[model samples]
Target: MDVRVTDDADVAGAADETRSLLAWLTQEDELRGRVTPQERPPVPGTLGPVLDGLVVALGSGGAVTGLTTAVVAWIRSRHSDVTVKATRSDGASLEISTKLVGPMTPQELRAFVTDSSRLLEGGQGGQGGPGPDGGAL
Candidate 1:
């Protein structure tokens, strides 16, 4: 999964917050070395390589579910309006915005996590259920 954080409210804060999210993800017991930032070549006059998004390797044993939960937790802890989008290798993606999720209750938050995990896992909200918000992931 490749995770990207976008913050239209503060361009400068996006990178900082993205790094913070990366740090938080890496700290998870199920993630550790499984997370790495995406590297891009610098433009003509840039000083160093560009770092954007994150490539997280999720395998068996509920790692994907754990990742979704951690991501929601990170978004809930943020003070800025940032949206995190995670794309799977198969091109399926899920976007979670801090602004949208901020007002959700604990149960709603858990459902959000569960729905995200299901969508990302190609289950589309688990069982024969509908996708979260009736939208494609």
Candidate 2:
């Protein structure tokens, strides 16, 4: 995998996040087989004012791993001020190019609700009811 950050005019924190993301990808077991970033040019137009950047993930082999979950999780976990858009090279193999925006997407809001619901469902005490002493609430 080759991840690059071609913009630097945004908040310094954004650049740091790109670095951290690349590091995490290289270190994670699911992504350890990938390669480090190839190029990270600073695109003045892309990053400026509030904060934003361009992120591209490239794959060299037949199939890649740690992408779907990683990408979605990263998007779902980002701050409210950040926005991410992922596009595949050919709508397959999970290759993605992401552009961050000052405002988040409406889809992100839907995802948040869905994730919260899932969490709530999982947090439920299970199928069986509680025992005599308020064992499960």
Candidate 3:
């Protein structure tokens, strides 16, 4: 899957901030051996200029839940004024956009990511309890 994160800070600093966030995200343990950086192009359906963004290619077996949770938490911690749009795509696609204004603890972020991941994987029944690999939330 490919994950893209765009930093929507002011135009003057958006590019640099996005680059820095991308570099930091690449070093995360959850992304280790899985994420590769890519250039940002103009969004396919928009007329806007090339966005100040970063792209990460995730290995097929990478842990999406862990990686997404960490990335969102890190971005929120560093850039409260910036809006972030994180998009994950394989055959199916998921996109989450947010600007961190109110308080969101790390635990809450993890739970949110876990639930989102489960839903993405088509496990929305809410009764299975565990994932396909026999892992509980």
Candidate 4:
């Protein structure tokens, strides 16, 4: 998973905010054992270790769900105007991508992340349940 902030007046400050958000995410109970923050290489134009984004590795299949929810909620609360993108790959062909544009309540955040995760997993809110008229139940 990775998060980057865009459309901010202070580029450096935005980077700092991203770092702060990353720290908060790392501290979340949902991600405590499931996500690991990775060291970022220096940027080409930057002089030091300042980063515009953060990258974390998810531990298991379920980790993606937790990490995504945590990241979106964090960003929504901290920097509502900033754009954030979180990406996760399974070391093969599967990859999960999530984007947030602005502030979202916990309920909205959960719904968004759940929908995205479902799409990424090639499903829509898990297996289809019984529908009206008793068809495709």
In TM-score terms, which candidate is top?
1
Tell me the lDDT of model 1 at 42. Answer: 75
Per-residue lDDT for 60-80 in model 1, tens only? 667888888888888888876
TM-scores of all candidate predictions against the true structure: 0.82, 0.37, 0.60, 0.55
Q: Residue 4 of model 3: what lDDT?
A: 60
Candidate 4 RMSD to the correct structure: 7.9
Name the TM-score of candidate 3: 0.60
The CA-based lDDT of model 2 is what? 0.38
For candidate 2, write residues 6-57 as lDDT tens digits. 2232465665665555564565565565534434444787644332333444
**Models ranked on lDDT:** 1, 3, 4, 2
The sequence of per-residue lDDT tens digits that candidate 4 reaches over residues 24-117 is 7678776664433444567898576655455554444665566556655565565335544443343222222223325345565456666554
Predictions in order: lDDT: 0.69, 0.38, 0.56, 0.48
Judging by lDDT, tell me the better candidate of 2 and 3. 3
- How well does candidate 4 score on lDDT at residue 59? 46
The true-structure Cα RMSD of candidate 3 reads 7.4
lDDT of 3 by residue, 21-117 (tens): 7667767777765554455566689664544566665554446665656666666667346655555554333343344322546565556667656
Pick out the ten consecutive residues of candidate 3 with the lowest summed lDDT: 125-134
Ranking by TM-score: 1, 3, 4, 2
Pick the winner on lDDT between candidates 2 and 4.
Answer: 4
- Give stretches of model 2 more than 4 Å off: 1-11, 40-65, 84-137
